[model samples]
Target: MLKLGWFSTGRDQAARDLLKVVWQRIKEGFISAQISYVFLSREPGESKESDLFLKLCQELGLKIYTLSAKNFEPGLRQNNREAWRAAYHQKVYEMIKHEPVDLIVLAGYMWVVSAELCQKLPMINLHPALPGGPQGTWQEVIWQLLQEEANETGVMMHLVTPELDQGPAVTFCRFPIKGGEFDPLWQNFKEKMRQIGLEKIKEQEGEKEPLFALIRKEGVKRELPLIVYTIKAFAEKEISLINHKLFDNKGNLLLEPYDLTERIEKHLKTGEW
Candidate 1:
């Protein structure tokens, strides 16, 4: 069995959803590997997503481990910057040391991992934009594209590096945002904004404590499938990194080098790129 370790902050619905999809895929025979353990940056008390993820892991018979940044700090600061990072990574590395983790997948991990950690294992991350798409958080990536009037955008699974979202590509799938037919996209964006705005209003009104639970719920619904597909490709040896280039099993580039917005739009209209 290919042993795997999952890393996520458990702050977003996508993170939870991604794991669920992977779990489902494994159950359905789309993936043939064992999720040896899950490592989380935050403890369950901090976020309901973390709580639920732990519960799911328990139900699935996977081991669970956590390293709280809050707890690690100060002690983490006792060492030099490099040493601190190493110490923190050691927490994660120790859990998988006894297990046979072939790959580490970052779903919604917020921190930029230390170079020491990357060098220690084969890891990959899924970004909410195309490779070299934008250098910001997922929300920022979308907002920046909107500001630039980009007509298309995509998601990519890539090798994780210290630099955010600068990883070598694994696979990318894109969709078009027709300039005139922007209603669907706009509606989606507006709905998200409205939901956030309402949540803020509620928090200010003191109806309930601030919660990130909704985001995690959405992740499980929308982002799970993509994560599963990416992992399936990896487990089946459908992905390869060669000379800093990522290739599919047949040696074709998984992500085309050029921006494919126009091509994608054309494909949407004519059914071919």
Candidate 2:
């Protein structure tokens, strides 16, 4: 069985929901693995959400370990945030040094991991874009896709490196954002933005643009499913990282995102977890 290390900040409902869904799948025998430990960046009382998340982990009987990023952020010499972050990651390293974790999954960890730590662990992260697509937060990705008039977007699980979101993808699912259901909305958004400029539209409407909203809805629906599928792939040995490069069980290098459209569509249609 794969010994998994779970890393999350547990900052929102989505983070909590992800843990629930993944744990449910594990309990249902869908994932051939056990979570060895859950490493949280925040301690109890940092926020109600994180506290509740910790509570849920305790209820599930999973080993829960925590290091408060808030408590560590202060007391950095020279006010060097990067230096402080690296030290904090070092502390995290000490906390889990003895655990036998095969892979680490960053579910909702908000901090940028240090390069040294990235080298020490095989980690994967959820990014709300396809392989070789826009880079940044999901909101930035959506906005960039719209500005570029992209026809497709996707969700991917990629290796975590010093770079924020540039690592090679392990698995992904793509969907079209143009034509069909999106044609009218895209057309209107383009025309409106051309008339009023993107800055003005953003100031006035924020993320409520029809096209943006629809695309986000489409992508959001696939996020958890993709994460689950990615974990399943890892647990089943369908995907592996050999020398920091992704490969299949046959040792074939994966040059493109593993297209999971059909499986995800089935799950979405069947309401399967």
* Top candidate when judged by TM-score against the true structure: 2
Question: Model 1 residue 87 lDDT?
Answer: 78
**How many residue pairs clash in model 2?**
0
Clashing residue pairs in candidate 2, if any? none
How well is each residue in 1-273 modelled by candidate 1, as lDDT tens digits?
A: 556788888775656777776777787777887788888888869778778777777787878888876567666556666677777887778767776677778988886787877766778887767666766666566556654656666766678776657867666656555444464545554565567753454355321211222222222333445566667666777775544456777888766532334433454467421
Report how far off residue 124 is in candidate 1 (Å). 0.3
Instruction: Please report the candidate that would top lDDT against the real structure.
Output: 2
Candidate 2 has a TM-score of 0.93
The TM-scores of all predictions, comma-separated, are: 0.73, 0.93
TM-score, cand. 1 vs. native:
0.73
lDDT agreement with native, every candidate: 0.65, 0.88
Model 2 residue 163 distance off true place after TM-score fit, in angstroms: 2.0
